[model samples]
Target: MRVKLIESRKVYDGEVSMRLERFSINGRTVDKEIVEHRPSVGIIAVEDDRIFLVSQYRRAADRALLEIPAGKIEEGETPVAAAKREMDEEIGYSGTLKPFLKWYLAPGYDTELMHLFVAKNLHRIPSRREMDDDEDIAVKKVRLDAAVKKCFSGEITDAKTIAAILAYRLKPI
Candidate 1:
């Protein structure tokens, strides 16, 4: 089981997508194409027993989504730094953070990995939410139980949201 690169080259360089294809194999030969994405961060911002979420329209999904605060780690930025920045920009808060789990968003075809964090002992700050000029984002707060319920209700359709809440529920205090 190994990726044998027969041929590979960068396909595109854009704000959201950078794709590549490699000729590969497990037991047989196959051409595998993967998108090389910037690493991202997901924050489960906690204050007492509540979690922060952002609701916005997703052009890809064509519906409003309730998701954990998240963004890509820019060049030369650590995942923790990106998470802190996203938490403040999206929720207007910064806090002492507890490192949590990390996971790949979609391993089948993408190279996007996400670092998950729990931020607590919080304080308010002015938000600099310059979400893509086309974005329509609204911030909200919810109890962890309610947020988990929203996941079951499919009101929270984002992967990072579900992963963060489930990890919080499973971790021992």
Candidate 2:
């Protein structure tokens, strides 16, 4: 399949955008609208069998979410750098991060790719990174097993969190 972008403009500046595109497949062409989002990084930060997570209200979901540390990949920054930045900003910690997985968060209608990482040997930072003006995050440390259970029990519903937990369990750092 070959896809061409017809037009794109940020629907929500700095967050998401609407994209008009045309796809050619097997001599047939179809036009589709998509959500063009900046790629981001999500980290499964671990220390002594515990996972660092953050809880916050998600306006789009109309509910609070328990999720791993994550943020958009800033321009000219590598995925690992973004992971480190989010970890410090959200959890007030730093660690050694290794690539675990990469996947499209929502491929059918969104262009956001999430780079997942596993952060081990974490240490607390003297000062936490400032949260964004609109963000209020509560940090939580859950045992690895309990975090995994939360995923199966539907308590941890964030896509990146679920995927990262399972991935780390499969191949720990």
Best by TM-score: 1
- Writing each residue's lDDT as its tens digit, candidate 1 over 70-142 gives 8899999998888878877788889887778879999998888988888888899865756656567788989
Q: Give Cα distance to truth, residue 156, candidate 2, Å.
A: 0.8
Stretches of candidate 1 off by over 4 Å are 127-129
In model 1, residue pairs whose N, Cα or C atoms come closer than 3 Å (at least 3 residues apart or on different chains), thus clashing, are: none
**Alpha-carbon local distance difference test for all models:** 0.82, 0.87
Residue 171 lDDT (model 1): 88
Residue pairs in steric clash, candidate 2?
none
Q: Lowest lDDT 10-mer window, candidate 2? A: 5-14
Clashes of each: 0, 0
TM-score of each: 0.91, 0.90
